[model samples]
Target: MAERADAARNRQAILQAADKLLRDHEPGHISLDQVAATAGVGKGTVFRRFGSRTGLFQELLAERAARLGAAVESGPPPLGPGGPPGQRLLAFVDELALLAAQNIRLIAAHERACGADPHSDPTYQRWHRHLRGLLSELRPDADADFLAHIVLGGYNGELVRRITASGGVPRLRIAVRDLAQRVGDVD
Candidate 1:
């Protein structure tokens, strides 16, 4: 029991250290040695906990995706349950774009390691399903399923990072709002 508890503590420490490193430096530049050192654990501990750098990144992305999912499912309005469909759709897109921008490096690393399409990610699937439901409400006659994919396309990590790098998140938010407004309109 004590050994399990220690393992859990070490895992948390490694995750926290990896998160800090990802945020402070480019994900491509981070090494397991750095993470182990920062977490005050042996290099073997990190390998035992996560297997590889790709595994570590997968865990981080999964953790972040779960938090975003919880926020959209149960948190306050606009992103959550209480807003009008159009408003919620707009807020959701903005939030997704912001999230992608914030975690671009980590996300890119994960995609590269897995050789997978970003649209196929579990997080993207949930957002696509939620947006499709909202789009159906906003425009009953439109192809909501396809439109959800279209809306999400605009929030691609590289695009969000490029646009925001030039003008910042406020500009990215405004662009997302404009895109949402266009999609939200039925006629």
Candidate 2:
């Protein structure tokens, strides 16, 4: 069944409201009531649409991840599939670092949304799969699975937040790039 026009509009409004709020406030500090008010929809509408605070934030993270996924699928190198494996792997890790630094709050919310086992989250799984595939291509003899997980560990959300808070996004980017380079390059 198709969604009604007003329902679609409400969903857009609610999503926009959440995006706007995230610019200035952490997810924990923002409320569904505030979202509904900014969206000009009823509080129940927000609740019914998203189920809970985590649900709402999860949807937001999913939207952003989908955009990144699309770029990785078809956009230009070194992010897309069209580039060399080593360069593409470096580019992908750079992107992840940037995501962690720029969207720390959303990352925290997403971490919470996934509870204790974030490795099982679809977003993280997608990233891991992409990284593993690229790592496999870059270093055929290396353990791509473990390598991908280790790459992700370096930009763990809380770690990125702390690093970025201390004004270290540039260093983080460089370190991640160097790590990817070293891991992909055979001695």
Candidate 3:
């Protein structure tokens, strides 16, 4: 069923409020009450809509990844469907590195929220599937499933943040791309 107009409005308000708060404050420091107050909504509404802090962060991460998901599903070459597997692997890693670099706080928050089971998250599962498919195509002899997770290990948000803090996104991107190429290259 379609969301009620007022519900949609409130959701947007809550999300906007959360986004604004996240930009200035650490996620651990932000609270539902604060978000509700910032959005001019009630605390119960925030709780009802988001369930919990982890759920809210998950939604935010999903929103951030949606465009990349769409591009990988159907947009254009490299990041999309038309490029060769190696080029697409490079592009995918490049974009993910950039996203992780740019959204360090959000990624960090989500990582903390997810704790030990990030593989269960939908956005991550989608990206993992895509990477696995590309790797399988590029390396029929390798264990594509294991290799996909390995590639993703390097893209872990906390790791990405640490790497970017020192060497920057450019260096991170190059390293990840090189990793993808090395792992996916046929022997």
Candidate 4:
């Protein structure tokens, strides 16, 4: 039990350090040595815990996705359960766009390292299902699944990065709001 607790503590430290580093610098620019130093752990500990940089990225993605899912499941506001379907959907898109803007560098690095399609990822699938369910509530006769896919395209990391780089986060949020409005009108 002590060993397990120690392992958990080490894992949390590593994750916290990596998350801080990723927030300060792009994932591609971060090294495991830096993570280990920040976490106050040996380099071998990071390797033993995560296997590789790609594994570390995957874990980070999963953690972020889980947090987002929890917010949508039980948190307050338009992104949660209290709002009208249209408002909730729009809020969801806006939130997703912000998250994509914040994490695009890490996400892009994960994609490059794993060569996995973001759309097919389990986390993305959950988001798609949530959107589809909301769309179905608004327009039962329409193709909610396809519409969800289309709506999610606006929140893609690459698109968010380009828009924000060219303009800013506010511009990207405006674009996302525009897309959400159009999507919400698909009844």
Residue-level lDDT for 138 in candidate 1 = 93
- Which residue runs of candidate 3 sit more than 4 Å off their true CA positions? none
- What ranking emerges by lDDT with the best candidate at the front? 3, 2, 1, 4
lDDT at 55, model 2? 79
Candidate 3 matches the true fold with a TM-score of: 0.92
lDDT of 4 by residue, 34-88 (tens): 9999999999999999997777777877787776788789978678878788888
lDDT minimum window of 10 residues, candidate 3: 178-187
* 71-121: candidate 3 lDDT, tens digit per residue: 898989978998988888888988988888888888877877888798888
Put down candidate 1 lDDT per residue, 1-187, tens digits, no spaces: 3569889899899989988897898767888999999999999999998898877877887887787788889988878898888778877877777787778777766665555556666666888899899989998988989988888777666677788889988888888778777887832
Cα-based RMSD of candidate 4 = 3.1
Looking at model 4, which ten-residue stretch has the lowest summed lDDT? 109-118
Clashing pairs in 1: none
Would you give me the overall lDDT of model 1? 0.81
lDDT of each: 0.81, 0.83, 0.87, 0.81
Shift in Å, residue 132, candidate 1: 2.0
Clash number by candidate, in order = 0, 0, 0, 0
The TM-score of predicted model 2 comes to 0.84
Q: Which ten residues in a row have the lowest lDDT in candidate 2?
A: 178-187
What's the true lDDT of residue 125 in model 2?
A: 88
For this target, which candidate reaches the highest lDDT against the unseen true structure?
3
Clashing pairs in 3: none
Point out where model 4 deviates above 4 Å: 1-3, 23-25, 29-48, 51-54, 65-67
Q: Pick the candidate with the highest TM-score.
A: 3
